[model samples]
Target: MAVSRHLLFAILLPMAAVAADFPPPLLIAHATVIDASGAAPLGDADVLLRDGRIVSVGKALVAPPDTQRIEARGRYLIPGLWDMHVHLLRKGRPEAYFPLLIANGVVGFRDMGGDLGFDEIARLRREIADGSRLGPRFIAPGPLLDGPYPTLPSITRVLRNADDAAQAVLDLQRAGADFLKVYNRLPRDAYFALAATARAHHITFAGHVPLAVSAREASQAGQKSIEHLFNVLFACSSQEDALMREKARALDSTDVDERRQLRAHYLQAVLDSYDPARAQALFALFACNATWQTPTLVQRRAYAFPEQAAPDAALLRYVPHDQRWRFDPGQDARLQGRDAARQTLERRYFDMDRGQIALMRKAGVRFLAGSDAPDGEAVPGFSLHDELAELVAAGLTPMEALQSATRNAGDYFGLGDTGVIAPGARADLVLLDADPRADIRNTRRIDAVILDGRLLQRAALQALLDQAAEAAAGP
Candidate 1:
């Protein structure tokens, strides 16, 4: 299903959408607006939406004679959230999770590498655009490109040399992938070749900094966004050159026991060798290049302390039987047969990860909120809110945390009108019972969600949750 870039664009024109079947003009009156444009919240304002785009926002606005309106006094309005990293195809239950995501106000996302092919994802995208589906708008990397010895073979395409890597960039682009997802184990030559090919083709490449490449090298090569802090901690170590040589071997080895021992050794080494000066320089380089980071602290914490990662009883009901094993601590590979010393070291690594945020922010490095949801203990829609909480705990102001999922996402995607509340912007918004700027956790107190100008009130949102629960419970 290889499509030329021109044909792909023609077919995907619906993606730049105003909902095809939305009702007449809708008015939301007396609501306080948190526009996510770094502006002060507007008090007691009125917002008008027509044809799936915001038509006006002011202190008071009148609507058409036949307009539908929501009296939103005492509520706060904000842009709908985006989970920057997700894997919708891994478990293959998008039918169930789509409702859950919308219920939690996730209007958009970026799918990292997954099992679904590009053609199928494009079909889903079309359905969502035409108002035939109930899910977030997304940009996806159909399958990730990895090294000769591919990791996660089910979702990876192996590139053994520079030629293969370069060709893959062209091939994935023809297949209509939004961007190239580069993974670990890539040889240095292949990684750079992929980057060069992607640049020539006008497609961006993002994801892991391969074992053979430094974060600085990846940034220089124009990797757009780095996910999960892979390679970053090691790159910030004073002993980076020596440690990386050892770390690369650890990852490339086929022997599990040998690999685990090597990983344990380097984990402690990275912790002990962290150099703030080195990190400052690295962060400065990242800022200079405008590279974004999706640290995904929620999943990292789950991996660090699996015993405490279990979801609460309420959330557990949403975990399907086939997927529940992933939530179990016993299934955590990091915890299996590890000694007390390794466990303590892992905790310290997580704390160090949290500490990196403050320094990186100070050095002008920007972030995007991602939960790596349904990976480890990250639950589908709910885990995004958890990621925000983790970001605030890690030193982001509530506004900064909100921007990671809203304004920053729009900037990253180059969609100027998607993540803000203003005239001509997409009518995707969230209404909260409390002001999220006052306390980040108030984001969870959602009163309603408006997607493409069609409002879903509190009862409607609850029905979506109930529908998801029923699907999860079914055979």
Candidate 2:
């Protein structure tokens, strides 16, 4: 449970060279401030920033005579967003995605497991700290801790026993991981051991609820956050225990084809046996335990209805050539060779997932906005906006959707001064050309971004986008 020196450095150095990179004391005059604190927007507000922190926020903020000022009249300002779940170094060059994230107003992120080594992650952190890179501040578990037979063995630490589980947790904690990234296919006993070790060390472990463990058990075991809503649907089944047993067998199987068939059958059984009463009870339990959910609905939707994964020309301009194939359903094996009945089942599962999300929200289960970007049709940064829209479509109010990425994210990560715009808060603000409160889609109408007090106005933001596109286009 001991935090590594590197982890401590990452936490302590919020902005190591901000004074040199940013302007003098800066002020934004006459803008609508949507602080994302579940409070009403303050109109005609002025916010002053100095040395990477908000100096003041009010109707009239006094600043030094030489202070740099932005005439933000008619614009809306809110805390910069956080993509609670991301895979920055998963597929493409991680640096190439940084400008895209910043251009879309994502100032911070939690990188889900990727292929990068801890040393590489540390290097990226150093570059960002020294203002040598344009990117989001991030916390990551360099790679996932998966079962002995992992889905992505190349980017995983395979655990075989209780001893392995315990050691994995401690090793990741000491390797500067913000939290342990658990995965599917883990043995039940090993999962419990991992969870116990995490709790003993006062470290957090979160990710997929292992197939051998039920979601209820995962919630009770203190898994901090559930990603991709994995196993949640099955837990809402009236025959949950029966389905879980089948899942356990699937996990233990040596045959890949058998495992795939078993998983498909188990998922169908879950869909068939879903009970509203059971779903409600499970959601209540999650609420009670404060188990956070990061559904990554955009990615789910893409997988569910892959036939509709037509390439988006506008968004595609920013996607790297090698990665653009992910936007085409015809190229995906899962999307191809699906019969009519299979398509119907996929649609049904997706609808139920959205319905369950709505129910969970009403039951007071807190959510974190995440787009499993570059995984599905989800494009980094832009997909986060799609996620907010999807959240709203699933019955969240626009403000609530916005909060999932902002206030809720800050609370989830325990980043005190983040995700809010107030005196003493981090100077990571997004200026929107339209008010997001009126429509969550307005979050995409970003006019400017202020990262660690260094303002990127419209032109600078565009430059970031242009750079990203050029990178995507390759040399």
**TM-score leader:** 1
Q: How many backbone clashes does candidate 2 have?
A: 0
Runs in model 1 lying further than 4 Å from the true structure = 1-20
Candidate 1's TM-score: 0.96
How would you encode candidate 2's per-residue C-alpha lDDT over 318-396 as one tens digit per residue?
8888888877877876565566876777788888888888899989999999998877877899989999999999989
Candidate 2 differs from the real structure by a C-alpha RMSD in angstroms, to one decimal, of 2.2
Q: How big is the positional error of residue 82 in model 2, measured in Å on the Cα after superposition? A: 0.5
Q: Model 2, residue 448: what's the lDDT? A: 90
